[model samples]
Structure formats: C-alpha cells, structure tokens
Target: MRVDVHAHYFPADYLDLLTAHGSRHTDIARIPCAGDAEGDIDARLRMMDTAGVDLQILSAAPQMPYLEDAGNAVEAARFVNDRYAELVAAHPGRFAALAAAPLPHTDEAVKETVRALDDLGFAGAAVSTTVLGRTLGDPSFEAYWAALDDRSAPVFVHAAGRDLDSPQIADHGLTWIVGAPFEDAVGVLHLLRAGVPTRYPRIKFVVPHLGGGLSFLLQRIDDNYLHYHEAFPALPSTLLRRMWFDTVGAHAPALREAIDSFGADRIVLGSDYPYFQGDLYTRAVRYVSEADLPAEQVRAVLEDNVRAVFDRL
Candidate 1:
C-alpha cells in the first residue's frame, strides 16, 4: 500500500537509442538521475526498498519528448512504452508503469495511449506540462485530453527540464535548482486556467513536487482569479483546490498547508526516486506522521489517495 507514484525508469535499448541519436537537447542526459545508474529498473527498485516503498509506479522522464519531431517522438514513445510494458510483465506486483506518449502529435499520442492502456496494461500515461513549449491547454492538445477523458486515464504532469534558453541555466544548474519544479508549476497552472478540467472532468491529473509551488501560491492565484473575473471572463470560479498534488518535495509546513487547503483526499504520496531530492518523500511523510495529523488523513495520503486515483486503471 506504500505506493511511490512518481518513480522513473528507462529501458536499456531506449537509453541506447537516445544516446545513439545524440539527442543532447534533453536535460535528462545532463541530469544525474536520468544517467545510467538510476536509469535501470532493478537499481530503482532497490532504492525503493531502501526507502520503505512497497510499490513504485515507473514513468518515463519528461525529457523523452524533446525529440520534438512528431514522427520521431511517436516512434520513440512506442519503444519506451513497449519496454515499460515488458518491465511490468516481468515484475507483476513490484512494479507498474505509467506509459509515455508523443505529445503535440495529438493523433499519435492518442493512438499510443489507447494501445498502452488497452493492450499494454499500463497504469496510465505521463506527459510533461507542455508539448514542445506549448502547454496542455493549447488547442493543439484538445484531442489528447479528449482521449484521456474517454478512457478515464490518470495523467501524471511531470515538470519538464530547464528551458535551454532560460537565464536560470546560467545561474543555477538545471537539475539541482529550478528545471523540474518550474515546469511542473507551469503545466498545472496552465491546465487549471485553460479550463481543461472543466471541459473534460474525467481526466484525473496528478502534479508532483507538492503541486510544484502551487500550494504556496494558491492564495495569490485564487485572489487574482477573483479580482480579475471581470477582465478574465474565461477563468473558472471554482477554487484551485480542485487540483491534486503529491507530497514529493513538501516539508512539514508545506504538507500542512496543502492538506489544509486542498484536503487530504487530493494529496498522495510521491517519491521522485533516484533524483537528488528523493529523500523528500520519506522526510515529508515522517513530518506528517509526527506532526499529529489525523491518523486517517495520514493513511489516506500515504495509501488511499493513490488507490482512488489508480483504481480505475
């Protein structure tokens, strides 16, 4: 029941293919976690065991989409998903896979999503906040959202790596400081503001890194929405609390704030395993358990919330 919903793995062939292609655009190649040591499934599972995680939901790194060319991205997505399915087949209970799809290529992404879900038995699909710099709410991605809604699949909105042109890359390194969480927040905020959820209510979305700083900024976002309703008629009146988050980078204060704002049912356990911040999961959980949160709420965040989200899959 101790499910780590945000773990990652890439098959050897896929890794080799990425390397052989000399695809240097992705930060994964530059990031330590996406390197060879943590890229293997067995090593990731071993780390999970050490962290007291009983189940790890394996997902492809968001960098996989940097292939950019829709055709190439689709082919690579198929390979990655097929390999992910093979891994799940190899280890029934120990592992489950959240398949990847080639986004921006809505038709191909949808096709791959159905194949992965129906034939591959994948738990769900993983997509970065944006596709080639375009957020999921873009008109180009409506078809992809429609397909996910049709299947009622859970989509993991992971943060993309640092933008190659960003100034932060000059100051702080991509993996160490900003890349991941920044993209995560951007994706979540985009979807919330773009009316994706309102349009397709069945598509369950999970944002990691304690909602990627969203929890900390909820009041500001909500206040802005309230204040700008006249100017921004398209903004949804519902509170941002409708979105779900994971306790990945959250500490005690963050966790308490998220639970207080979003409630426990919407927060699940997430371990960005093998990443530099992997320990955040254990630390956050310990803090919650020790801080005198209701036993039932703590259990829900650690176990039930994940089951509720993934049970359909």
Candidate 2:
C-alpha cells in the first residue's frame, strides 16, 4: 500500500560505531543523508507523511559494511541489523526492513542472512553492487547466494558511492553522477554473465535506479551475447524478467522504457526518501500517478508489486 521500497535508515549505535571506525573508509558526516537522526521514528513518520508514503522498507544506505576485516564488519552488521529489527518492531505497519550484512565476509554474510531472515523477520537483505572492489559475481559469494536462494529472499542491490580515484571520472562530481550508475550497471551485467539468475533462480533480486540504465544497455548486452553465444546460456533480458526494479531516478521516459523492457509487475515504487533529490519523494510518487500509463499499471508499480515481492512481510 503505497510502499516506498528504497528508503534508507541507519541506527544510532551503528552510526556511532561507523564514526569510531576509520576502516569504513569515509566519514559519516560526509554522507549526503547522514547527520540526520535517521533512527528517529517521529522524524521518519513526518517525512513519510509529507511524501504521501504509507510505508517504507528501511535499508542501510551505501555506508553498508564492506570492510576488509570480517570481524569488524560482522559486528557492525549485527548492530545495524538489530537496529533495523528494533525499528520494525517499534512501528509495525509504518516500516519494514531489509537486513544489513557484512559483505566480502562470505561466511559471516551468510550467517547474518539467516539470522536476518529466519530470526529478525526482515523482508530481505540489502547489499551493494561491489563488495570491497569485488563484484557480486565473485566465486567467494556463491555460498552467500545459495543461502539467499534457499529462502527465496529478496536482495535489494543498491549502488555505493562511485570510485572517485578513477582518472576518467574524477572530475565534476562524476563519481556521484556517472560512476554510481556505472558501478550498478557493471555489477548487474557481471551477475547476468555469471548466469546467477539461471543458477539460483529462486532468489528474488531487486535492482535500484530503474535497473541502473539497464533498459538502455540491454541491447548492447544482447549484441555481445549474439556474437558469443557459447559464452552465454541466456540473454540478460531472459534473466531480467526474474528480477525486480524500483522506480527511483526513473522519470517519464526512463520509467516507460523500464516498463517496456521489464513490465509493470516487475517494477515497484522507491522514493530514496529523506535524501531528497530536488523534492524526490513527492515528485517521484506524483510522477508515477501522473504518468501516461494505464491506472492498473500505476497501481502495480505503486503498491501491488511490492506486496508481491516482499509477500512474507
């Protein structure tokens, strides 16, 4: 019911820990949506009200724990996941959650996935495109993938901030502008190449930023696949149908392309709330409602699709 599926919220303790740990590699205060009391339920509710969102599936922002030390990452993950569980418990219908896990720490990530799903009752797990420079398609993550597949859990793949050190994209804030979307596209394409959708068909994956320009890039991927049929068992289009995308950063044209490519049932509402990209929340929700699509399609993207994807919650 009017679910904003791509909202982010960090717990107080987790923020403190992140502030204390230099290994996270960035200052929390520097985060765009940071410094706001994200864990404050009243503030969250007020923002949701203003945005006309009935519910929000809270997730960790890109500040997700992806450090080198497994122990530190695991501890941070527990703190984050526990805080998410607490929020979900404190406000039942207003908020749901996707558990945070220590990516790059394969075994611990798997364990946290189990606890988050089986014990914490989170709708899914939130993960980044790359884990400490390693793409999601890395062999090290097979067990982790298998675990999520076993439960058919939804995995929301969000883009971490771009790699600013790259020579080509270091200028004009391209890291946030171009690199973020680029990383998402690359990571997703890697998964497609690895046949992850075919191998672990049960895991329900959700990609943000309207599949991160994937609608526009699918043709290129298909062209490559056509040239090397032996390398690909199936086209990205085939596997993409098995996944879902959220309507963040997708305006009329992009959203239309996504619907044409991935269909309405595979799309859901996502506001990227409280991080307002020029009144992102209200404008995004309004955009869908006012789009040229039929009312049924709007309903599917705004409400029904989310219910279907995260049905357990």
Best by lDDT: 2
Model 1 lDDT per residue over 1-313, tens place:
7887887775555766666555664444444444345545565566666666788787886656446677787778888888777767877788788878877788888898889888888888788776666777798888888888898888898876645347766356664366677778767767866778878878778888877677777677767877866332244324345567888864777788888877889998887765633455456446657656889988898878888788743
Cα distance off (Å), candidate 2, residue 142: 0.9
lDDT of 2 by residue, 5-110 (tens): 9888755557778667654434532444433465456766766777788988888858787767888899889888888888788788998889788889889999
Per-model TM-score versus the true fold: 0.88, 0.92
Model 1 quality (TM-score): 0.88
Which stretches in model 2 have alpha-carbon errors above 4 Å?
Answer: 24-40
- Each model's backbone clash number: 0, 0
List per-prediction Cα lDDT, in the order shown: 0.72, 0.80
Off by over 4 Å in 1: 19-22, 25-40, 163-165, 169-171, 174-176, 230-239, 276-287
**lDDT of model 2 at position 149:** 89
